[model samples]
Target: MAGSDIKQSLRKLDFPLCARDALYQIEKLCTRPGKQMELQIDLMSEFVFGEIERRRKRNVPAAIQELQLIEVQSDFFQSPGGIPAVRNALFLSLYPAGSPRYKILGNLVSLAITIHNKAVLNAAGIWMQQLGSTSQESVGLARHILNDYFVLTSKSVDRLQQLPILTPHFTANLLTAIGEVYKDKNPPTEVLRLIGEWINDNPSLLLTSLMDNPALPTGGIPMTPITPIAGLFRWCILSPVRTAAEGSTQNEDEQKLYSKIQHLLMDSVLRLKSSGSNKHAISAQHLAATTRALTLVLQSFSNIEPTSRDLAMERLAQAVSSAMSANCIYGNKQELLLLLQSLSYQHFLIEWTLQTYSTKAV
Candidate 1:
């Protein structure tokens, strides 16, 4: 069929059917090898973009479904030049939040991450930034995307680094997402290595940015949100001291790497504890998140050597205790107590295990 005929048909039909047909045609065109079909692909993309815009407000749900199909099912977005236009179309259609359409948008975001195409990532990043501005729901979804999909490897980092605009807020959110992933029991070691390298490269800048938010409305006192910092420490503590092989000592290089990460984590925890002195700056939510993160960090020490684990537990305990004492004005006392109780129980188990092992050895 001719391009004009297809465009005419797209206008006549509803969004869902139009999108399906448009995607099918685009896919068929894309499958043909070489640039011979480039013009056809561009034309189909424009047609899809235009049709979606035309019907966006009137039938947003349908438009979103179409976008999802395009993102997941077609390679139209595989073209670098076409990415921005398609991305803008999706972003613009994502208005009037809290609609069922958001679920589809969330899936599209996931697909973009999975695709890992540079152009798509840029688009997804921009869309995330925009979503973050809208509401808590959108922000929550954004964090979910980060936690579930964003891989903290060199390539992913490079994509984020090369984004045309990596605003401070976006960077903070990105770090927070990484933190959530680190909260997992067995977050990838590559993620740890990447973050450790990043911390080492610019030790103060990222942490300072994370910790030094402007004063909240009530006072000029600076209150840093503890979630991201907590995630980092949780990840650090969870980092393996040795490989899976039992009784195998780490080589010199591995030992040095472990020591460096341990030091970085200790320094970060100390910084967080010191920040607690600004009690007026901290809030109930901040304190709760901080406590929760610290609890997780403390729990992660179960797999480490006796000396290193003891030192980590001590520093974490001191940090948590100091923060709680200074910021007693905020946080749920009961919740904090429970977390501490859990940590204490875990610590006891670890100690008991060590003592039992020592006695047996003797």
Candidate 2:
């Protein structure tokens, strides 16, 4: 009878507020001098979050309500592993793998961005990384987000690009989402175009999945000097999406769109590497990363036009020479050496790259 009464009381309580207060009090108690032991703090935290998780399962409607309410409350997600329990519960209940509530995701994502809550964004990013890989819900969510930017059209860069949160915090997860969405079928040109625009906007899109990526866009493609993040541009733009059969209109459009993506990426790399002479403009890491990225992009397409290929290789050689003259080989020489070694297969780069490669550390 008391258990039944507990359920009745839980349904009526302001669980989000109560949970927040509970966390705040626990923090105080744990921090008070001589009030708690070191291990005790962790134990208390786990107990509190564990109970919250259980309560969410027992009353999902209440969990969903808390999910919305917690967003407005300051310091709600501050407690480590404290608030994500509620988030996970709500997502599982509201967005089941089979049948998710699509309409709710936009407002949730948009609100998350509008409020500019770092904790909330981080939680969402990590959550997607964990569950999004196999979940059907993630694929649908990706489509919904992508659709908001570009519709299925062959003509247009004329529309306003309303990409709010383009950070790898969310975009990295899109890798999994993209995989699930187009696992079996050919990639649509519209999607390729949408991502190309994103590459132009997000400079460090590849740096994460680094501890987490830590961007908005106004106009030109900003140079991405950071290595892994620049590599991310290479990964997404050159992703091996399924292609349509040859001679078909679908194949032609997809290839044309993909070529544009490649060019955009190549240009970004070229700009950053060329900037290697301006130590203020680019880093030692820049030339190494960009050189490797361009090589990988070059290798991916066997049929890349000779003119473009030759021009790219020639530009790369100049950039390397310029960067070397600027002493790019001194710093990050270990990393630079590894990258150059990896590119030995690209014999066109073998000339200066093989004989000219030097390390300060050596």
Best by TM-score: 1
In model 2, the number of clashes is 1
The Cα RMSD of model 1 versus the native structure comes to 13.5
Give, for candidate 1, the lowest lDDT window spanning 10 residues: 214-223
lDDT of 1 by residue, 1-362 (tens): 66667667767765446655665565444444441355454444444443335555454565565665556433544554443443333343333345444555555555555555544444443444344422354455555554444443334544433222333333444555555544444345444555556556644523443444431223223323333444554444433332321334445655455457556644654555556543332233433454465455445545545655454444445434433444423444445444445456546543443333322221
**In order, how many clashes per candidate?**
0, 1
163-210, model 2: which lDDT tens digit per residue? 325345555566446545654344566666666666566644432343
Q: Give candidate 2's whole-model lDDT.
A: 0.46
